[model samples]
Target: LPATLFSATVQTPWAGIVAQSPLVLVLTGAMWITYAAIYFLATSVFKRTPQDAAVLSLTVALPNYAALGLPILGSVLGEGASTSLSVAVSIACGSVLMTPFCLLILEREKARAAGENSGSTLAMLPVLMWRSVKKPIVWGPLLGVVLSAIGIKMPDLLLASIKPLGLAATAAALLNT
Candidate 1:
């Protein structure tokens, strides 16, 4: 997964991302809105517990974009299209932001279920945020992005070695999904 994220980050065109920032924002916004709506409905209408509602909302809102979205998008957009850039950007946003938000909710719910006083939300915010950011899923792409932004290039031999592993990881992810 880290290898895949590194490749995707390095390969993605930063210029195209900046050019299509507006569309990327729209896509990210839509995803968050969908998550919020589903969570609200699940909690209020269905009378589900917070933990259950969060899980349902996350499952519905965040599809396997890497496995499904990229292929379909590449086909329709003829590959390397700006629209694909938008999807990539939105995926990054969801990974960095929405994921932590969901984790925070779920953790709080878990604590509540265990009858432990997890303290106020604001008090726990920073620790949860830090924990979430430390996850490989969050940090791996971020590291890639940071390296790419600074124009660092891995040796051809090293990248070659990693590419197959990345591809295999992609397949593994799809299989898991």
Candidate 2:
């Protein structure tokens, strides 16, 4: 899937089609935040610890979009429907936006439990966020977007080598269900 994402974002001229609107990205991020908030609040009524609430909320908030949504959407909607692009955007938004928020919640919970000042952790959030975004899951698609924007073409041999991995990802996803 990463290989296909790299190929599509770099080799194809579909950036405009993939990233049609900022609204989609905004809505995706908002949905995750709303879901997490709601889940956390709802779970709080159960008398669980902050960390437990954070974990429960995270499980409810993060969708299995890559492993489930992408394959189903590609098969059901067809590639021309821009499902791949939507999936890519969804992935990017989830990684960049949802992950940090969840981390913050978890970190706060930990600090509270340890009787430490969470203000220090909050102050370091930007650095922590930068580190989080450097993760391959986040940076891989980000790199693809940058390459696509610059009109850089992936090497044919590299594409050929990674094509199997993409195919295998799709196959494995389908078979797992």
Candidate 3:
């Protein structure tokens, strides 16, 4: 199936899925937030340093959703639009939101540890966020999303060119795990 059709089918079922139970969204959000909070509190209590707590919280909260979750979902559920959407949602949340949020926390903690003025950490947040946004992990999927939303079709040749790299990345991640 074409990428466009795959996306459309994924989106079609997603509305129904969401309509059937709004609780999924609520639960997902609450779960991630709770995980972050728990890790932050636990690490802070044990480490007794804001920087260490922030770093540990990130590791504890964020999982390798793309590499691991996608493969497991694919194997158990079989290939389908829902699986694709699930993978996309997991990747987007992990990369765009969680990674940047953790980075921000880490930066703030580091600043505090360095004895920077409190105001300076606040001042530095936008810069740190911009840096996070610019990172390839965040930017690549974001660009793909924007382009797809605008109905821009990627060239077949370009897609063909990147297929190997994507496969290689998945393989590398699996091997590392």
Q: Which number leads on TM-score?
A: 1
Residue 63 CA displacement from its true place in model 2, Å: 2.4
TM-score of each: 0.80, 0.66, 0.72
Q: In every candidate, how many clashes are there?
A: 0, 0, 0
Off by over 4 Å in 1: 81-84, 111-118
lDDT of 3 by residue, 46-162 (tens): 654655666566666667665676668888999887776666665555555666676676666666767763586568888667766766666666565555555566666776666
Error of 1 at 110 (Å): 3.8
In model 2, what is the error at residue 143, expressed in angstroms?
2.1
lDDT of 2 at 138: 54
**Which scores better on lDDT, 1 or 3?**
1
Task: Return the candidate ranking by TM-score, descending.
Answer: 1, 3, 2
- Quote the lDDT for 122 in model 3: 64
Query: Pairs clashing in candidate 2?
Result: none
Candidate 3: residue pairs that collide: none
Candidate 2: C-alpha lDDT: 0.64
Q: How accurate is candidate 3 locally (lDDT)?
A: 0.60
Candidate RMSDs in Å, in order, are 2.8, 4.0, 5.2
The best-first sequence of candidates by lDDT reads 1, 2, 3
lDDT of 2 at 51: 61
User: Alpha carbon lDDT of residue 136, candidate 2?
Assistant: 59
- lDDT for each residue of candidate 1 in 1-177, tens digit (9 for 90 to 100): 666665566555667556767876776788789999999999999999888888788778877665556666878877775655655666666665677678778767666677764688787787667766777767766766666667776678877887787668768877887
